[model samples]
Target: MHDTERMNSGEIRAGIGLALVFAFRMLGMFMVLPVLATYGMDLADATPALIGLAIGAYGLTQAVLQIPFGMLSDRIGRRPVIYAGLLVFAAGSALAAGADSIWGVIAGRVLQGAGAISAAVMALLSDLTREQHRTKAMAMIGMSIGLSFAVAMVVGPLLTRAFGLSGLFWVTAGMALLGIVLVVALVPKGTGALQHRESVVAGQAIRSTLRNGDLLRLDFGILALHAILMASFVALPLALVERGGLPREEHWWVYLTALLVGFFGMVPFIIYAEKKRRMKRVLGAAVAVLLFCELFFWQFGNSLTMLVIGAVIFFTAFNLLEASLPSLVSKVAPAGGKGTAMGVYATTQFLGAALGGILGGWLYQQGGLGGVFVGCALLCALWLVIAVTMREPPYVTSLRLPLSPTALRDAGLIQRLLAAPGVADAMVVAEEAALYIKVDTQKLDRTSLERLIESAPAMC
Candidate 1:
């Protein structure tokens, strides 16, 4: 493997551009969550079920379209898919802005979700970055998402108050347009054909991803996490207003406080997990914290202090779990199956969000806020049990090897590569002309590996 350098100016520019693009689009989506439950009630023919559906409709389309959009990007190119997705997203925002009915809003949200460009965007990022710096680039995107969500939680209500819900949707549309401009004007163009195996999906990898028990547990964990998040919002806004005596516009203050505190609180634990090699322990504790927060909300939701405390705990645990899950997935996935593993993880996440909305709305309609809390708590409990089986994520990194077709087919060569010290796993895909390897950096025998590769018949 070549020793990749630190990110250069162009790489930094591309990473920031892509991060902002992702952040802006996510802001458009998340800006509705904090106040939508109460505000959306004004829509014609709105009911709990329909409102929940409207909130979650995007996930349904997003979940269904993610992989296909990713695969399409591989064939046609990333920028085109991204542009089309933003346009669709903008169209959805426009439709929602014009809608007077909840069903219309739902339709628009679904279209917004149908603009599934996350995979394409990530693939594009992978295309432009070096392997060593790829994680940092991806982390920038992740941080953008976290920051966007936090900012949206605070900004969404203020926007709603000033311009009304329709106006907010218009702003979302504008954000999507801005995202398009960024993609065209700022994001760098990659040379040559799309060639990132680490971030591209393969059909053959799916069965193996499914069969990996540890990876399955992590997927289920994300599903439960997002489900609880969507469901909580379905009731949280109402609880803040009716029980806590906070008005709609003031909701941002609470969210701002909780998010700030939770984000900071989560950082130390994440650092501890990484430094101490206790990722599984930290992850399990975070799930347990989530369960406790749900139960606490159920019992003491009416009190302002409890609401604030629960929000703090919920977001803290949420941030911790959210950050850890992806890292765990990367480690647990088979060497060549990161993309397939992530695709499945993402699908489960969206499905969970959709289910949460429906379940929360149904519970609220049937038995109010308390019922919603109880239902979510039960779900978390189930997740905790499953989470217990999740093994510690391997401390490893992925390396891509350029292997010639002939060398790839050489059984002895493949065996020798696998037997190399520090190589945890290796997968050679002849069609892609690459060998994917998982290596523990501290233990990798670079000299020996280099000698073997140099002695090989041809360069890929």
Candidate 2:
């Protein structure tokens, strides 16, 4: 039976299954953020620069490995790919847990990134659902990511308080193992294998992804967002310990407060944007808020309360942009190249993480918090300018069309599709009868799309 025919609870649960699996993977990385630098100064004879390298090594490796893992999932099957990744991640966590030196931890971080399963999970999600409900499925994954990030901020410091960073690693290992169970027992298996070779070629896929002035803007947006995020953390603990007069033991309260405020702050805006189709407007407002916050942080971080306020605004905009960018990618990417586009996007995302860590550390070391915030302010300004240039993303839902014999046999179908007013692009895989089309919301005519498919000549 198709996923739509299943009970709503089951469908939602399936989405949850994917989300939790993703969260398990992400938490391993995020758990170290809040407390590591402060405490890590002593462990493995680390300085801020080495700590930053340890923190970012995962992204460096993840950027390199994510696409290959996803492609492997298409061929070997999602379940196996995920299981292997999980085991590998667990092994890395175990190594980090027992590390005697900074190099050992860095090596472990690299191993952790090597276990890239994000693409596989996404591909599995695509297989488990009908095309119409794919957005909903994807939304679940996105929400989980945000939620996990928020949850980790509050929980990470507390975990450190309870058991130290090594304990965090052990816990991360346990979570990865739990994911193995979820994949094997809960996630349904089908076309989510690792053999989708066409998904990897970076030709039209890379060109389309790169040339889109808007997508590049968002790419810059995320790179800027993550850069600020990493930079802030680099400065935050030192600020809290040295400036805010907070002990390392109590830092979670600040994180807990900022995260709660930020998550709540972004939600209404997300709802408004989606319901009213004001994505561009909402996004613009959010970016402006972000840039101002960076400036605010630069001016006001000397005061503890002002720093808290700045943190809230920074994260508020961070959450909003994180949620919005993927939506825009879905709206803008060529339907035939979504996977490829995402592959490239993922690479950029991880590259951002790595760059953020490296640069953020350098800035913090050279000029203290002021320098870091100045860098963040500059990035936010660039993102603001870039985002301001984007056309509003369409609110129309995407539909994945499976190929039929008739649709394939028609030599002129691609031409007919190009002629359709609302159709942006179409890719018809004759053998698979899988058709991918993007509809322009301004000119959307659903009946025309349906009728064209119904009337097409023999394809098979």
Best by lDDT: 1
Q: Please give, for residues 117-153, the per-residue lDDT of candidate 2 as tens digits.
A: 9988887776676655667787788878877887788
Q: Candidate 1 residues 63-123, lDDT tens each? A: 9999899989989989999999999999999999999999889999999999999999999
- Supply candidate 2's per-residue lDDT for 257: 84
Off by over 4 Å in 2: 1-14, 191-204, 415-421, 440-448, 457-460
For each candidate, give its TM-score against the true structure: 0.95, 0.91
Clashes of 2: 18
- Lowest-sum lDDT 10-residue window in model 1: 451-460
Name the regions of candidate 1 deviating beyond 4 angstroms: 1-4, 404-411, 445-452, 455-460
Best by TM-score: 1
lDDT assessment of candidate 2: 0.77
Question: How does candidate 2 fare on TM-score?
Answer: 0.91
